[model samples]
Target chain A: MNTPFSPERAAELGDAERRGSAAQLAATSGLPDTSSEAWRYSPVSDLNLDELRVVTGAPPAPPDAPQYVTEAIDSLQAAATVSVIDGFVVAVELADGWVAKGLSVESAAVKLAEPEEGPNLFDHLHAAFAPDGLVIKVPAEVEITDPIVIRSHLSEGAAGFTALKVHASAGSRVTVFEYQSSESGGLVVPMTQFHVEQAAKVNHVVIQDLATDSWQVGRVTSRVEEHATLSSAMIAFGGKYARIRTDSDLAGRGATGELVGAYFCDGDQIIDYRTFQQHIAPDTLSDLLFKGTVDDESGSVYTGMIHIHPDGAGSNAFQTNRNIKLGDEAWAWSVPNLEIENNEVRCSHASTVSPVDPDQRFYLHSRGVPPAVADRLIVAGFFEEALRRVSIPAAAQIARTLIAEKLDVRLEQP
Target chain B: MSELIVDQLAVKVGGSQILSGVSLTVPGGEVHAVMGPNGAGKSTLSNAIMGRSGYEVTGGTITMDGQDMLALDTFERAQAGLFYVMQAPTEVPGVSMFDMLTASLSAQGTASTDLAATLSAEAAAIGFDVALLERSLNVDLSGGEKKRSETIQMSVLAPKVAIIDELDSGLDVDGLRTVAQRVEKLTNDGLGVLVITHFPRLLHELNADRVHVLAQGKIVTSGGPELAIELEQTGYGAYVEEETPEPKSGGLDDLFSM
Candidate 1:
């Protein structure tokens, strides 16, 4: 373990109690390189762990700075604006109608000694490393028109953790937009926990366009209540190594979850994604579609699964992963798994990993588009489906523009 | 002067020759029909002319208005006044027909593609519902609707040469009449029409100037409309292989060689 760290550096763990707790958390969280199912495709040990540092100071303020403005960010229906700097909640603006209670977002030193839920090791990690995060609570029967916007900024050499807890009461509806960016170069680890009450609805949007030299790790878990709906989107277009895992549980009858994602990776960028749609109640519906494109020597991995419990009869689920590699040097791997413990359920998964069709490109080129332009056109067309699902027009166009840049082409509007 | 000339052209797919030394010329203002049974390479001929990437050009030359068509890519060929209404047009999801058509036109460097203005006029001319153009390009469109959308595309692009591939498929009598009317209008506007089909019903309605019967990848017979009538009545028996085994004889050998 000391191979990469000197004796003095290893002593940074401080007291025996803190070292014991860190070791215990690392061990029991099943994050080991050997036995964790989730880590099978990705090896964290290969990340040069010792080289990663916790936040020492504020990240460099970007020129023309932060990816989103307060106005555009707050435009999401009924959503307020919350900005996090170096793992601390710097600014928070709640909506006018919603009254918040019993939820406090302060420095981790002011919170409990340990995470209330042991399974959420990142919560404890956030409590330890993060200066602050946020806690949002919605009481019963309240409906919000705007989506809350949360922007997390990371600068070079800045390693920070933030934990977001969103609890929606029965019949409450809310939408949250999470934007993550890295200024200069750095790494960020973010974990989010969502609790949806009976008949509630939650729509979440995650936008990641980090600096080229940054790395991002994000995990999201949701619990769906009876007759509730959770629609989530993860759009990743930049960063060197961006890994996202979204796990959802439909634990009550008539629950539905729709997950859509679109990513564009180029150069030596590596994008890893893992998702799970668990059915624990009858008549639940979960659909996931993620489309991506890889150019140059970029690599992408998508491993997804839909698990149905025995009591979860009459459930219907669908998962599709489609990607187009613009160059022979680019690579993509997709694996879709279906685990069924019930007899009367309907679930299907399909994945297509192929380069752009020569015929399709020729067809476009025959119309006078150059070969490179034709490739970009078809690739954009390939991603239009997943991108179209996004509600904001500017965000959609920005996503497509980023994709064009990733493919080394300009977005030529007709 | 925008003419298409195919001189002794040969095309192949997957190592099998489909069009062999086929020579035909389509002036800027005429309707030509290529009638044949299944496997006659009628569709293959149109696909080859469009420079569809999968096919190989084995021999001969294709020229459009004195420019070498074979030297151009599919899009370039399309830009040079050639439009192939695919037999099965790809259903591109999330791309609206208006956007796709206008983008295609702009890509080809067309100057008259104000989508909203053009769409309204074309929709009125074709009696197409204006709302339909806003939907995803060909996605969820019915067979007849897809054909109509292709026709709408033709109307918008207004290319010099328009190749219709089996426009009769999935169309009822009324739809066929509508398509024929549009094709007649296009032809009257001086656009060259190359209609590839097995059935001559649409050709007869549109009054083809020349009828070529394609057999085994080449035009075996070229004549007036009478040839289509003849084949429609005779059922391609002369070109098709005999179903029943004939005893070995010179008569059978002559019949075998078409």
Candidate 2:
């Protein structure tokens, strides 16, 4: 058995209350068994929880800037930049006029409390080991034109856990762009929470390009209140096994949420995504679209659910997931389900797994395009449908570059 | 000797014969029309010449400028300056017509600045709406619009040898006249053209140099442009046999001969 929870570790990390709660969770709920429905088709069984140790104190000096971070810094003229090294907040910089306008960023410890609903093993583990949390608050009536960027770089053989909380008051609007990269093999777990108040709007984008030997498990949960809008996009391109779970709760009437994602996995990589669209109030709307392509021996999994309660009458929800298989050994699994107890709601879900259309290829070939070039153009067009919906120009460009790199590798093969 | 030639060609699809020992030629600076009843292997001949898949050439020779085209892939033949305007253009989602035209022109070594100017000029000359360029290729387009877009593509490609298959089927009177005038102009400019049609109006307008009548997978007759007018007046029944009986043998002799 593992050593008992230490009071010293608690004092160095957070309060004793958080430590007790995390200890109780760790003792009661162990890692999920492979027989569980949610864990099926996932590589969680191969993970060893005991191998990861709690990290404390200051992290090593910040390493050289990663390629993705440099590219993002060059492309986005951000209003502020936050650098996180090994889950430690190293620096936070805001533009000149930002402090006077009621925008603040601070370091705080997150309370190790279980979610009211849908508590998982990873959430408990993250609560037990999180180093420090970052809190970003935007006051009422403050609108920021430039995006705030967050960059995370994980070093070799390190296990890091981090939490971030974003609060947008009524009538406020902000955009956040997060870029995560790694130098070598490691495990990174992160959790994010968003509270969008009444009539507020938020745009969030996450771009992950980790090393091939690394593993990432992340969670993004948001609550959109009355008349608020939330637009989120996720572009995932790297990692050995990268998985993210998103939960969007429309808590009040007239709220809207949109989720879009584009991912390309090659070689032996695996990208898994799970999304939950919860409509609890009347007259709310949620739409989701995810498109990805897998080549070589890679695989992808997408499972989404649209839940509409009885009070969620007059709500509209849509979910779509499409995947293209470029190699004979590549595989994709998509499962979209709807749970509706309401009588007067509109809900639809569609999922497709297919190879490239022969007619499209023939059409291109008849126009003098080579086979490899034709596939490249088709794949680019496939991702463009979702990328065009992204609001940030720099984020979209970065995603396009990653996708082109994957296509180039495939083209070079005999 | 620089011409598109098909000599005693035979083709099959899915283990069934389609074209049997058909011969035709279209020299430079001339127009030739192939008139036939439905299912006489007219489209098959065009498709075979373009090297489209599934049109297996059992015994044939297709050459342009004395280079064997049957040994090349579709894109290779296209790179060799062969073009074909299909009967039913395919609609590709998420790909714009302007992008396709640019890619085609760039494949032939056209510069970017020249591509835009040339495309605009060609579209205007063909009476095609410039707005169609922004829309997805052939998606949500009417039959007449699709034919017009094909004409624009042909003009942009400027191929050395062009095969126009059933260009008059979905066209209106004005569209037919426009296409005929375009083909006439191309032929006048020394581009070899093979025009396949069922109606005689396009041939009359084109002032075709030769007309070939195809029946039962073979050319039954060949003559000047008047042949099209004569066949239009009387149907193809005169050239096709009414009936032919199956041969029979005596049972004892057939068995003993073996």
Candidate 3:
């Protein structure tokens, strides 16, 4: 079958036999058209797959962590840290009795988990082109006090593919924070998965600050078992057209999950999100909130779905999406949905797309605050609600700093 | 110190005259009260002097310290030491009192040192919760809390003239005393006071130097603080009888025709 990719491009992707077969399969299936519901409002046609030259094979030598990655680790109190470049795990440091796997040269490669429903065109493309990645698998009953910091700082390769999976054992507690950046986040498809065993707890935070002219199409999927809990937060500040699709399953009784996101876009960027919360067991609960701001002719889209089956009786589910448009041309689309087939359940959803409250602006002015400064404060304050819901302590502060930097470029002028 | 002078102020809101030839002076280091019954154009005078939108000054002159105040924006007017504590201050969610006060002072290049300490001291003086100073600005606060909170803000700015509307409406006896005492301290330090209220209890606490009766879109009379006591005894019956009927309202038909 003729494909957008060259056969040699597959070899450039990886020497792994698994990758070669996956690439061949993707060569036949090709990318998804906009007909698919998931591809709606997405810039799928703009993806020039053959243009990205990803470094997928083994490195020439043991690579060293870049200054940015090393400095970020030093500034953070990390129980373990892993740095990856162009899909290769280059550095790993474990401290204070925390054990993880797939961080060494012999065992760096991890088998990608295919979605049960089937792999989409992007998933197959990711499997075909991805290289050896750092997979942090935690042992049972071990409680980690600090975050397992994962830095995917890929700038050399024009684009790359990375897949990270977290498998938390029963009765264990762990926190993971992932930071992704590139000259742009590049035209990469990064995938993440989480499996929370019975009675375990997991907290995850993801921050994306790609440069202009970048495209990041990513997926994060998780399953929570009996009595376990999973909480996740995502913060986005850059990317020309970035999209993340997340799916969480409450598969066991008494399981719980919470999802939060804080995103800011400026200068022709479009940050999109589509999420699903599946309640499959009785007495399960799931809550989700995503808030963002669009400025300087930029736009954002948030579409969420919640499903409660017959077994999901006596469950609770909630979803809320709020956005502030700071520029005259800025825009947002917020859609929240719910599908229930059960009788005893509590579910609600709310969404808003508004400019800053004029009364709030006037109140600040009444206090002698300048109009420009009052605007900056209100925009910064809009993120406090979503940021406080993040379990990771450092996520809020880091997001605040990045937001302030973005505000400075638009505000600080004569 | 100089006085805030409103001369022959005739203002219209939405093409209806609310204040007609109303004039008063709030000199620094003295308290002046504007008392009247409801719909007597008291708040309109305050809103117009502060240059709020929708309050059009059809014919008037408002000057402060010999500077033409109408040429300045509302925030610029505020930056130049004009402070007004409104009747019901609106809530701004997610913006902390610290953020507002810090930016308020810093925007003016004023000394914002020890802002939290200053807020705590001022809030405690008005019997307000100090912890609320760290929370969002007036969000979820009770009516009395908002009044006291505005008083604290008044103390923080220490403006030359403070135009307070309904200062005693939302306060209990104790709350009113403490809030009045805080403002009294600032007034003693040469801060001019323009307290607008229908009740005379706050005027007694404030100890006004001048009292003006505003009715029929104008000030009908002016006297010493003793005038407030006299109005309290006699009520606004005589002044309200001089109703300059609104031309737009054809009295009986305007109320029941619709």
Candidate 4:
């Protein structure tokens, strides 16, 4: 946990990678400005980057995961699996001649996603101090329906930045499941980009079950081409402060994008989500649904924007976010916005912040269910809708199990 | 055999006196019917027994079998063998009918290994839509369907005593007959029943051994089932005058109640 981001580690990078990191570091002075609309109401301003030792040395050996994690992976039976500890790719296993590669500094620098908007502080830091990661590239005209799984984990008292890229060629189909777990006092920043070519189908589900004391700030930028579809879901249950910004840019005509974010927080943990559904072409469609629950003193924030460009005529976009607060002191904030520059487009947004319904609780109790079990049943049932929306069946099953496990803990204390 | 006895029950709800001096008895294996007009404390009696919030039992002893029910919570009373068929059953979203039955049966410690098949058969018997077994419990269900769901629950759980409050409100002739048959079937198995209804239509199908007139929070008169037939013609105008005007809930006054 020493100064792994020191000048000695900086000297390890090649000339081009070093120059790219230097440019990013010089352009961004500090953390992303919280006053900006993109960072409004976020907790990143409270993050102490100096307190974290950004890893740039040889990554440590991956630790033995807890039984639950291994059980989840065993249930998946994924076609290909990759493990990245800290920032280094430690293991990769493929079946049926799958396609994947260990990412290098050169490839990581090239795959880095820098939008028209300037890169923020964490984004800059990721570019400056990232190590070897993983890349999944599906060949054209091929169909790999089985998921290509990736496990990214970080050790205690250190920060990890894993750069990952996924490219689905034309007429190809694939699925990716990325699961992240970290130790206490860990800071994890993962940058991912997906290029879904024309007429392709790509699905990605990310389950963030980090330790309750860890912090994570990540981003996913995906682009869908003509006649293609991109479906993404994120299930977050742990972390002191976790935030993920997801942007699905429909850049081709007749492209479609579906996104879902489901999370539950307890005991002062904060979960934040920011999403952008960018309809850049005509005849595009995008739908987003985010549902979450906050208990104890925890809170959450969900702010989504649907932008339909002028050329996006005949586009249809919808955004809905709902959150339930279980504790008297818990809070949730939902803000949805629509920016339409086309006359023929249709767009709608909805959000709500409510508590566990008393009438629902009473009905369950009157049926012989205990008060604590009644609450657990209501909350478990509440997430069924969001979990069913997960495009991957296996991921949905694991998410459901994780949710039940958490509820079981509640049952024990109750 | 089970018995439900209520002695001099007094109740208040949301700063309004809903029931006072209400007393009734339902012995094992018998069906007793209570007929009353709107806001005459029929629903209040059932609500107070079920321990609904906002309904305070100022004074009463609700005993089931032999234990004091007032000392137990709603679920404890339910697990102790009591069920109430509400007039307006609550719609619990995200909880499917199957899940509700599973949790209830499990909590009751009587979950048969083949619950799916038993529930399917019981739903068919109670005239509940079998296809609705997959949907959220009572959510978006029609009034009759909600009533059928409640009846299905009663049939599945097979509690020792059941208090039916206006179960015939939204049922058609066929639905009413099927529900009555289910209730009668349970009653024959030593289940005591206390049914409250506004119309004689349900009694025509249900076999009630005794009938009582509950007006103004008190049971004014009790007689054989013939009283239900006679009251169908004469109404509560006869016994209502002899009883004091307790004014439990005036017609317009109930509308403003919480």
For all candidates in order, the CA lDDT equals 0.73, 0.80, 0.81, 0.81
Q: Write down the TM-score for model 4.
A: 0.89
- Stretches off by above 4 angstroms in model 4 are A1-8, A16-28, A97-110, B127-135, B140-144, B213-223, B230-258
Give the clashing pairs for model 4: none
A316-338 per-residue lDDT for model 1 (tens digits)? 99999998886579888898999
Worst 10 residues of 3 chain B by lDDT: B246-255
Better of 1 and 3 by DockQ: 3
- The digit string of per-residue lDDT tens for model 1 on B1-258 reads 468898998998999998888888888779888877777788789988988866799999999889998998777787778887766677655556665565566666664636788887777676667788887666787777777888887877778898889887766678778877887898888899888887766677778899888776777889888877876666565765566322331133323331
Best-to-worst order by lDDT is: 4, 3, 2, 1
Ranking 2 against 3 by TM-score, winner: 3
How do all models score by TM-score? 0.88, 0.88, 0.90, 0.89
List TM-score (chain A only) for every prediction. 0.85, 0.93, 0.91, 0.92
Residue B135: error of model 3 in Å?
1.6
RMSD of 3: 4.7
Misplaced by over 4 Å in model 1 are A1-20, A23-36, A56-71, A100-127, A362-369, A391-397, A407-414, B241-258
Evaluated on chain B only, candidate 2 has a TM-score of 0.90
When summed lDDT is taken over every stretch of 10 residues in candidate 2 chain A, the lowest stretch is A1-10
| A270-377 per-residue lDDT for model 4 (tens digits) | 999999889999999998888899988889989998999999999999899988888789889899999989989989899999988888887887888888888888
The lowest-lDDT stretch of 10 consecutive residues in candidate 4 chain B is B249-258
Q: Could you give me the TM-score of model 2 versus the true structure?
A: 0.88
